[model samples]
Target: MWAFLHRFASPPHFYRLSGRMAPWLGWACLGTMLGGLYGGLVAAPPDYQQGESYRIIFVHVPSAWMSLFIYVVMAGASAVALVWRMKLAEVVAVASAPVGASFTFLALVTGSLWGKPMWGTYWVWDARLTSELILLFLYFGVIGLHSAIEDRRTASRAAGLFAIIGVVNIPIIHFSVEWWSTLHQGPTVTKLSAPSIHLSMLVPLLLMAVAFKLFYVTVLLMRARCEVLERERNAGWVRALIAREGSE
Candidate 1:
């Protein structure tokens, strides 16, 4: 298992493997997303309190979950790159930033849309909301820092360290509701016992969450593959691969 793991650390091997898997993952993502949307929007009964407006949860919840999930992935990849000097890990770390940022943006926007009717205000300085906003800024910081540096290695290392440091905020974001009184609803689906959500709603939410995860994987692989090619452009293997492609 360890041997196989190390083998995939090779850029060429990962590039080929990801290329083969990405298409399948892409289709799976689409199918699951469509299924989840149908279930959430059509099949699930409207909330007794929030009514039809609560349907936005299908999009808002998944986007919010992905925002945190992707950040953790980026930070973990950064840790691996820093400790092992793995080029693939570095590529993955940087490639994930934009995706994570986009999710964070979606979460924020959707949260605001939900909040307007539910909380009677579109924006607030609530703990969860503020920390989530900070998360978006952190994503921007990582991308900006990487682009500002000319040397890729230096940029990656710098961004990696920053990501590592920024991880402190994740727990804060997760626990912010408990740590402080806020209008934002607490965890409904991740509770210790059975989820508070009804089965009909839970099914769609879970499906949407799975779709988001698969979507992230599909896009991450595509982005990491492109980053690898760009970073390895001067390598003999890259030149040979380009030549082969051109000839084909």
Candidate 2:
């Protein structure tokens, strides 16, 4: 298993593998997103309390979930790059930052849209919201730090350290509602027992979450492939690959 894993640490191998997998993942993401959106928007009944405004959760909840999920992935890749000095891992970590940042931004926007009708305000300094906002800044910090450094390896190391340090905030974001008084609601789908949401609602929510994960995989692979090509531009294999494509 270690040998198999180590083989992909090679940039050429990962570049080829990711290119082959991206198309399939993209199609799957599209299919799942369409299904989820249809079910969430058309099939599911309105909430007894919030009514149509609650429909925003189809987009809001998935984006919020992806925000945390992608950060964990970024941090994990950063750790591998730091410990193993793996180029592919560094590419993955950097490729994921912008995507994660986009998700975080989407979550904040959708949450604000949802809040206007529910909370009677567009923004608040509630614990959960505040922590999530901090997360967006952390993402910006990583991106800015990575771009500012002249050396790619050094930049990866710097960003990796920051990501590792920032991971502490994930737990804070997750438990913010439970640990403190906040306008945000607690977990409905991730509870210890059965989820509190109805099955019809739960299915679409779960589907959307899965679709978002697939979307991340699809975009991450594409971005990582681009990063790999840029880093490997001077390599013989890369030049040969480009020549072969041009010839064809």
All candidates' lDDT scores?
0.94, 0.93
Give the distance in Å from residue 95's predicted Cα in candidate 1 to where it truly belongs. 0.9
* Per-residue alpha-carbon lDDT of candidate 1 for residues 1-248, written as tens digits (9 for 90 to 100): 98898888788888899999999999999999999999999999999999999999999999999999999999999999999998888999999999999999999999999999988999999999999999999999999999999999999999999998999999999999888998788988876877889999999999999999999999999999999889889988899999999999
What would the per-residue lDDT of candidate 2 be over residues 1-248, giving only the tens digit for each residue?
A: 88988887788889899899999999999999899999999999999999988989999989999999999999999999899888888999999999999999999999999999999999999999999999999999999999999999999999989998999999999999999999999988877988899988989898999999999999999999898999999999999999999999
Candidate 1 global CA lDDT score: 0.94
Rate residue 205 of model 2 by lDDT.
91
Candidate 1: Cα lDDT at 186: 90
- Cα displacement (Å) at residue 2, model 2: 1.8
For candidate 2, list the clashing residue pairs, or say none. Answer: none
